[model samples]
Target chain A: MRDRINALARLVPVWAVWLGYGWVAPWLIYRGATGGLGAEPIKALERELGEIALQLLIIGLCLTPLRRYLGVNLLRFRRAIGLLAFSYVCLHLAVWLFLDVQDAGRIWADIVKRPYVTVGMVAFVLMIPLALTSNDRAVRWLGARWRRLHRLTYAVAVLGVVHFIWLSKGFQIEPLAYLAVIFALLALRLPDSKSLERRTR
Target chain B: MANRWKNDLRARDVTPEAVYLDRRQVIAGAAGLGLVGTGRAARAKVPEPNAWEDITSYNNYYEFGTDKGDPARHAHRLTVQPWSLRIDGLVDRPGDYDFADIMARMTIEERIYRFRCVEAWSMVVPWNGFELADLLDMAGVQAGAKYVAFETVLRPEEMPGVRYPVLDWPYVEGLRLDEALHPLTIMATGIYGRDIPNQNGAPLRLVVPWKYGFKSIKSVVRITLTDTEPPTSWNKANPREYGFYSNVNPEVDHPRWSQATERRIGGGLFARREPTLMFNGYADEVAGLYAGMDLKTYF
Candidate 1:
């Protein structure tokens, strides 16, 4: 089963994944521009972009677990997934800055004053270094430090979910569900008791 | 109806039918001309009532569901025909008031007023209903009454949202006696000369123009004249975020978001966010209601 999965993964090109996922941002923009996203299109577009970015982040996090537990190694496409998630995050921020809240001063005020907005901004800022160093050259240059730097993804994931939960009105389950899923994914990454005992021995 | 308050906003001020009915086509055309995000800076000063589609379709009536469109989709299941309102507490003639009888007795009139939401979105609506003062008077408000409390219908089988504790069920809202008695306050029954669609609070709903839209509770089932300030649903849910006196003051920002500006519904995708007015542009008439008090603190 593992060999079959590896063979199938080899058939799909990383460039194909990049091209297919990259089209989502432009497609969402087109829908918003043409009024296909319903009334309050800008808000809908912003939310869709944010959700897609979150999904991509979740998918990117699943790559290692998929390989470890199932021996299904599609690790080659992780870079594309990570870059796509970053691209979607950038699109989400653009829609919010340019379409939703168009005032520069107000945007600054929100980032400084609003707790949810501040959390979201911090997550986005943290993503900048990770995105900048996603290339093979940086991995080769930094060696062990590159993996340490990429661990920022864990902080970004938590902050993103926190931002979602804080911005939601009343007691909503949707954002909380995302929080649960992200927590579960992070928990899966922790070394098991047996593994810890073996390493200590 | 002759003595009724005149409509300062005329029918022409309503969003154009072509623009609303074929909104996508119009937006597509605008996008073709590179005018999509140009903003509404050069437009007329008078606020336009949103299209009937926008008014009825977009709502925060969580009785049906939390999403804005959920009410429109699920409200049809609501039975509004057999509706009756219970008027009790501190009233001389306390009893169940039949909806039909109440409609027949009251003088219904048109009121085009600005409706602002706490989420910094707004719309102008032409509400058709009688002054809430008239209804309270019919129930004979007692001299000891200091506040007016309202309750929304709670049918868990019909209102799917009530199945969950999204908010404490049987959504409640209240206003100080003077605010409830204000002429600007009405029990809205219809929109644009038609019976309000179930989604937009059919049968009966409070329309307090000076307050945030949530304070104007929808599908009201009970009203009580009380001697003490009553707890409101949103306030009960989050005291820091929602206050009892949720008057629309641009200066008092919601803890989570700024209330300084609002995006007008039916203003198209690229229209500029307009600065929110004190009392949602009815400050001249309603500002006196909050005199000698700090709105920021109350908010």
Candidate 2:
């Protein structure tokens, strides 16, 4: 029964992403369509998608720590989590590129001029390679190099936190909380967890 | 209800986002100071404009939370019924004016103004209010008064985010005495002919159309006329990013965002970005106020 439950749980990541995209994004879009995005629906929608993407990335980063320290392995589902996070990031970028900022010409200026936009674009740039390499054939062919390359995910996580922290106007708790959580997860992967890390490898 | 306060403002005159870009350059080239004004006679009548963007209760009050949607979701916890504004400092009649009494004594008017946020978003809102100058007149400003400072209500139990140091609580904003007394500066009581929504700043708020939205402090409870500039909340939080004289300036870019263009609210995802105006297109009326002083240096 325990083994069955663990097997069932691996599918949770796949279903979770589907649920998030299928339900959450559309619900917000519907609310926006129905005049629920408040005085500035476009802005609200744009920010909301970005937030969801950031949260999913944060969740994806949590898998390693949860297994090593807490003795609960979601290792089998890490691919799903990573892919889901990538989808969200893609959606977030699409919203900004196509919807929020419609002018193709002005996009370069925003990416170049605004610090928040610059940091966010940097995050998107780091995410593109990671998203492209999220398949089994690539993972097998690359082998040890694949793990080394995938380690760039940590930088993606760092950029994600930096992007959020810089994007906010005033001092905020949410962005800081995300920073703390990401750091804590990275900290848990240090020297002491060598045995767990090797086993996971 | 929204139609009741319909003053004769051309929809194009108020929004003017799509048409404003090149038109401004032409006007600037022709007039040399960009004052080929909206060119419409200011008339008063039923507006019958589109619905008020659903006013869907979303707000961006950092004292409440940093998120744009956080304020509307959380501001309802405020207990507003028995509210009173403490009018003090540099004024003769320094006392708490109960909400009911203040409403009865004030002369209400409809002002459809172009609203701009410091974050480079813009909206055209029809605000219902009495002139802030009239309120100052009622308080009999002392000769020494140099600035009119304002503060938002701070109730920890009611305002959940106040517990966090999102900002130095009891949000404060101030305006120069002359700016405070300008006819365009108003103490808004309502919008779209309806009582101001809690998220929109219930009971009372300031509306300085020429300045960015932060200058229009929300849920105001304190009005202090002072001899010096009062510390504004955002400026105190980050001076480089937010100036006390947060008048909409396309020339002076915010450290983080471009002030050159603004996306009009409710124009959906593909809204045309309009060139931001100097003093948010109230350059005709308020530009003279800053005649000699360099806005860049002050900003």
The most accurate candidate by TM-score is 1
| Candidate 2 wrong stretches, greater than 4 Å | A1-7, A10-31, A34-36, A193-201, B1-50
Worst 10 residues of 2 chain B by lDDT: B40-49
lDDT by residue for model 2 (B77-188), tens: 8888999999999999999989888889888887887788888887667778988888888889999999999999988888877878878888999999999888788888
lDDT of each: 0.87, 0.77
DockQ of 1: 0.65
Q: What digit string (tens of lDDT, one per residue) describes model 2 on residues A1-201?
A: 556656777667666656655577778878766556665677777778777777777777787877666656677757766777777677778878877766787688889987778888887888777778888888888889988888878888888779878978677888899889888878877777667788899
Which residue pairs come into collision in candidate 2? B6-B47
TM-score of each: 0.95, 0.84
| Candidate 2 chain A lowest-lDDT run of ten | A13-22
